[model samples]
Target: MPLWTIYHPANTYSDKDKQDFAKDITDFYTGFGLPAFYVVVLFTEMAEPAFFVGGRPASDTVRIVVEHLARHLDDPDMRRRSTERLNSIMVPYTRDRGLHWEFHTYESPRDLWMIAGLFPPGPGTEAEKAWARANKPLPY
Candidate 1:
């Protein structure tokens, strides 16, 4: 599972923008063989006064925290490529929009994750593909 938590000042994004951004993120994960349902994107809007940067309120800042439980990129090269791809994906949403943003990813053991009372199938497995196609957890 790739759980993405995005934080920005209120009114930074419209409903349509949020939906589109989430779809792009989900697509990125699905391309990697992860189940579509396993990619979760959450947008949190905060009041300007409640957000800060450099010891002062920053209304143009965005922060993303991501948790990866489905798999870990243990290879240095793979991690670099993944980061580059993700940054490119965010270019339009953040850099082009002039929003100062930063994101960090955390990896947890795959064994620690469960969906709908079932353990997710291994990467690239037929069972995993079924879950991806269904967009939900299913007995495998």
Candidate 2:
């Protein structure tokens, strides 16, 4: 499972923009064969008074925190590739928009992950593939 939390200045993205960005994020992980339901995105908007950078108020900085449970990049090469993919997906919403943005990821053991009272299927397994196709949680 991958959970992404995005924080930005208020009005940085419209509801539709958030929807599209969430879709792109979901697609990014599902492309690696994870179940669609396993990808969760949360968007939080902060007012200028509430957001700061380097001790100064900021309205153009976006911060993201990602949690990975289902899978992790265990090597430098894999991590690089994953970062590149994320950059590609984010350019349209971040860099291209002239916003300062940063993101970091934390990986947890898969054994700690569950959905709908059931453990998620292992990566690339038939059960996982089924969940990917269904785009929802289903008992294996």
Candidate 3:
């Protein structure tokens, strides 16, 4: 269950880029046995120039860094390497020497029962309906 929420200044991602990103991330997680229903990715764009450390404008440098990090998401070593690279390059390159780029990751055991219970049982044989009815009231 990896939910990716990307936030960056506007005009950052092309439609092709967005599609590729969604496909890659969904495939990656599902490959590891997480069902498609449990994984989601959201992208948000901001239009105004952002402020970085030292009061420098983010437009000057954020795009390159964002692209670089996005591409590296598939790398096995990205967890360690990406952090180091971002901290080293961004702190010095941005207007604010102390400004930090933020990335958040989270995982949780998927509650398939919760998802299944959200909808009525699909058409099935009488036995199937009986089973579903019998099991439907356990407070899932």
Candidate 4:
């Protein structure tokens, strides 16, 4: 599964904002062949005393850490397009907040992904294709 973690100061985002953010991100990932059920979004709030930037307390900073299978990040075009889409999601939330925002992505091995008691194959792989054929589910 893909794990998207947004880190910000506590109480910075309302519940509605978080929902919208998650929905937008899920839409983007689904377009890139991820199943909606397998994608996850998380918001982690840090208290003012715990939030920091440049080695000093900075509650205004917003940070995002995304973790996904390596297959998704292995293509240059996919990575570029995803970055742009992510920027679109963040702009509305971060604009004019006087906050510094950053996003970083990390890729883990596809074989490491385990869901529903099975090891799911990476996108566009022979194993994935076979599984899809057998399960008669969407190719994603």
On lDDT, the candidate that comes out on top is 1
Question: lDDT of each structure?
Answer: 0.91, 0.89, 0.46, 0.76
Residue 91 local lDDT, model 2: 78
Q: List model 1 lDDT by residue over 49-102, tens digit each.
A: 999988999999999988999988999999999888887877788989999999
Candidate 2, 15: how far from true, in Å? 1.1
**lDDT tens digits, residue span 65-129, model 4:** 88876346658998898788777777878865666789988888877777666677667677665
Error of 2 at 40 (Å): 0.9
lDDT of 3: 0.46
lDDT of 2 by residue, 51-129 (tens): 9999999999999888999998889999988888877777788988999998888999989887988888888999889
lDDT at residue 68 of model 2 (Cα atoms): 90
lDDT, ranked from best to worst: 1, 2, 4, 3
Off by over 4 Å in 3: 50-54, 60-102, 107-140
Question: Candidate 4 at residue 62, lDDT?
Answer: 91
Q: Identify the leading candidate in terms of TM-score.
A: 1
Candidate 3 lDDT tens digits, 1-140? 34566665666567876776677666654454344544456776755555353676564334321322112254658767745643443343233533235653432322332344553222244533453446332232
- C-alpha lDDT of candidate 1 relative to the true structure: 0.91
lDDT of 4: 0.76
List the pairs of residues colliding in candidate 4: none
With candidate 4 superimposed using the best TM-score fit, by how many Å does residue 88's alpha carbon deviate from the native? 2.2
lDDT of 2: 0.89
